[model samples]
Target: MKYLEWRINGFLEAVNFCRFFDLGYNGNRFTWERCRNTQNWVLERLNRALATRDWQNNFPNAKVFPVESASSDHAGIFLTLGVNVICYAAKPFWFENFWMKEIDIKQAVQTTWEHGKGQPIAEMIKSCVAYLLEWGKNKKQQFKAKLKQAKAQMTRYRNSSNPYHLQSFNSAKEAHLQALEQQNIYWKQRAKQHG
Candidate 1:
């Protein structure tokens, strides 16, 4: 979703999407406040996960936000599937990779040449630009692959019988949910460190 959201912005700058979070585990067992205590911890772990796939680099707006963990010890994760995923667009995000395409990191290097790009630290802009490009490429790749797989799965379901079709539909949904959980495990593990 983050990949999709980033691609969405590629073509349409205004394209934006949001996801809400509970910030806690099973609501019955824990409370949001307890989860709040772990915000720093959770984000610290999440940062590593996001870094693993270079996710944040690609989708600038797509992020994991904390509210009040509420009702559960698990801090809720507000993740917006990036780019086209949130918008659910039929068309793919079309854009060229400028820096890598040219094999020239001049503009990328020159980014810091302009002051105010990173006020606190002039080197910050360099890091941001580098991160953005790295993640952007990966995000684009992920987006295309995900989109293709979804299209294929949908086509298969469309061709099958009613029962199998429904089953396939449900199976696909379950798969997605599982994927989301797996993706979120990075942060989950981070929270566990406190234990």
Candidate 2:
């Protein structure tokens, strides 16, 4: 009991210091689990993720979920940063400003350029454009799928009656909100490019 009290005090102090709240999560509830058959098992939430009020405002849909640990004693955490994935009409080719900041961008561009060398100028441009388009399409699809999954999970939490699920509902909602925000940013940037 003394140890438990000490832990509780420490937790309260940490929470106060950070000015953050727990991000609701779905999936495994406990981060730490140890068991040997049905005779004995211990479970505890040893690990957690917290977000500030500012972070909550910025990403209302952010969530942190525990994934299967497999061989490990502790579960892995999955954080959703909130991005809305939608099926949009095909967009025109345009370079993304963020791509310039990627360390591999130079290498990827150089590789594409090398592959297109010795071809006619128009054909070379076409090759590079095709490569870039394919790359972008794949990346977008991956992001879209992840966002969709997070949204679906949030919906599930909303429909449930379990107290734990209800508690997590807010966190899930926040993650969804974050995804919407991401969509807003994506369109805003695209609009800026056209403007």
Candidate 3:
């Protein structure tokens, strides 16, 4: 029980820190690999708590979602950090289906491989790698471009002295976020890849 409380507290602190301070342990091994060996300790602690089913009322804001386990004895976890109750929104799966392409995606992958003619093995591999790289880059750019536009529109509110206009921009941003949330399936498909 004490351990669960500790885990919940750690989870809340980690999210709050990221939302405001951008400093906290991220248990993602890849992230740790890039910098100092900083583990996502906070997340790890929360996962441990769930495994024990030791939860209490000490945490009002912390959310714990059950995970579906295909083989493991314990379910996995879905954590929401830096979420705002005032703005309250459904959590999102960072991965999207749009990323998933049916065998049709093989068109992109195969086209890249098939074009490997006079090129050496290494060169052929590089060409295919470049194709996949550019595909990912294009997807990132598309979303970034849209987010940039929204930020620019919000900036216009700073120039206005009227409180009404300021509130208008705030609402506009909320609406923009909602639009993005509704399109989660679009992202899921974009992210899905059978190829």
Every model's TM-score = 0.27, 0.39, 0.26
- Name the lDDT value of residue 147 in candidate 3: 48
Best by TM-score: 2
Which candidate would rank higher by lDDT, 2 or 3?
2
RMSD of 1: 21.3
Instruction: Single out the weakest 10-residue window by summed lDDT for candidate 1.
Output: 22-31
Q: lDDT: which candidate is best?
A: 2
RMSD to true structure for each model, in Å: 21.3, 12.7, 17.7
In candidate 2, what residue range of length 10 has the lowest lDDT sum? 95-104
How many clashing pairs per prediction, in order? Answer: 22, 8, 23
lDDT of each: 0.44, 0.70, 0.50
Where in model 3 is the C-alpha error above 4 Å? Answer: 1-98, 101-105, 146-195
Over 4 Å off in model 2, which ranges? 1-11, 84-195
- Give the better candidate number (1 or 3) by lDDT: 3
